[model samples]
Target: MGTINTTTNERFFVDYRITLNDGQDIKKIAQEICIEQTVEIPEDCVPQTHWDYGITGIVEDIIPSDKIKNQVLVSISYHCDISSYSVPQLLNTLFGNISLKNNIRIDNLRVPQSFSQLLPGPRWGIDGIREKLDVFNRPLTCTALKPVGLSSTELASMASQFATGGADIIKDDHGITNQPFAKFEDRVQRVQAAINEANAKSGTKTIYCPMLNDEPDLMKKQVDFCLKSGIEGALAAPMLIGCGAFVSLRRQTDLILMAHPAFAGTFFHSNLHGATPAFLLGRFFRLIGADISIFPNAGGRFSFTQEECNELSDALRMPDNNILPAFPAPAGGMRIERVSEMYEKYGKDTVFIIGGNLQQLSDDLSVATGLFLEAVRNCACATKEIL
Candidate 1:
């Protein structure tokens, strides 16, 4: 077991460093870390909320290490016996806010002898999602309902058709906002209603994730609204808003969260300073309670390679031996035509989201949707039988 100082009671501390942008100061960074103990959780674990599961750890130390870039290094010690909790849970409680809040990096975790046995990662992982989705032999198909300029009725209607036509998860385009023509509340209620209608008639429980990107308070409201209306998940971009926002939302709600890749491009773009996408998006997001994280698949609009995509999938699906696994959703320029090949490449633990291709299939929404659905079902079933 890894011990900090072999002297007395094993104390668990987080050795971290924070780097500020140009013109930033240590005092400003210190103030950001100056927080009191704010315990988060619910009265009943079943009715849990996001704010209830996390703690507010303040910056305890600051260093002037020239070796490190615009960074701050600090160590946080926790006294509670964490032997009962899993590693993912411990990490979530410790540095869940690293990327979302101020510029901070968790260089190392000093686990005490008492809690060293806890495994840190997904339990069922990618294999589990495939089992749940029942697509083991091939890649999964995914799509998005985008260009949030349409009205609630339009969006809901599209959702209904998409569910009927066979898209696995009809997510909102990340760019969609709560505009006048298509308000968030009205759109969510209508789209959820449409999805419910489709599910009842088709015997398929398709998920409808609303783009719940707003201010902190409004974001919470959006989540609450989705839950009340029976929405399955939410489309959120952590970098654009904050990962802490999603963490808080997950603690409060019980819906699966599909993380979007927006401002996150900046982190993975760099080589030396920033964190890796697989570690941050695949591993950390799961720890922070994201059920499904959306990323740019290789050969799509973004530049992530096939190897990078596979590595990310492995990270997300890898068995944690301790924690629940989150699903890996590959979006950005995905299509239904390549469903089979994508499945073959990505394996079973994937939500292959097709966004723009759905729009180009045909003007007749119903026919286009039907074609897409047929392809997905055929591919998914064929893959399953082969497996």
Candidate 2:
């Protein structure tokens, strides 16, 4: 076992699930990873000078799992300098070539404080978001504007209604991009204006987070436009745009970043193929400056298990040095009727994002949105009483 250390040269830990092929040697496979992840050369070919300088990955342990035959859990520690504190390099060093091999999955990863501090984490996490919303002691209600064909005016109208009906945050759908029907700049300006009007009328603090997924230059322009329009945050699909894009946005502006899980499903779909939902949607996203990490909820249109959902929630809220807990926004097929159940399951520091159900509930968007907020309030009160 590797002892806990706080040195500048601390090591990063990676946990992988390795399934042995017929008659394949476990020790050999472990050594193969140690070579591939770091030196990318045969062990014997590696120069003694490189090994002496701590440039090689060390296989800490490999324990066969009793629950599953032919499966073993391998733990490896790599010297922190291998990544040079860069996100792209870190990912490359962690799973670059190994990702191509079969029967191998990255299960978990741990970065020491020295390396973690080098990354730009959440700027306005749970507490900052709560302060902005001014709704303490209750899970915040969020909604998305959707059905890609709508024009900028139509989308702005929907945003106004959502704010008027008391949604804490209104976000653009992941599909709402720089399309003809709703150009990015037009949609952002119109929707933010509408949301501001509704807030002025209702005296509510509803934040509008515009969706931004463009080239680096275009993304920066969109962010600047939103900020100039008095918008407080943005919704970014980190998987589609890349982690580097998300981190750059964090460093450029203090906007609240709500990470949308658009292309991230592959990472959590299989229990034995890729990362767990907790690590990808929760810890990793939070580490890269996502104030709110969104994921598909259990019993939704998606197939995430209840245990997986709980684990994701725990990962987002767990304590870490200088890393604030983010809001785990449970979305996808969410409805007004499930607010109580979701509230009980996720506790108070969650953001419930409902969409299609709200549109289907009533002809009037405001009426449906009001019902959703009422359900959230009722759930908060009921939970308090039970406690």
Highest lDDT against the true fold, candidate: 2
Model 1 stretches with alpha carbons more than 4 Å out: 1-140, 377-387
Candidate 1, residues 217-294, lDDT tens digits: the string is: 887777777877877677788666776566666666666677787887776664333455776677667755667888
Sliding window of 10 residues with minimal summed lDDT for model 1 = 46-55
lDDT string for model 2 (150-210, tens) is: 9999999999999999999999998998999999989999999999899999999999998
The models' CA-based lDDT, in order, is 0.65, 0.86
Candidate 2 clashing pairs, residues 3+ apart or interchain: none
TM-score of each: 0.68, 0.94
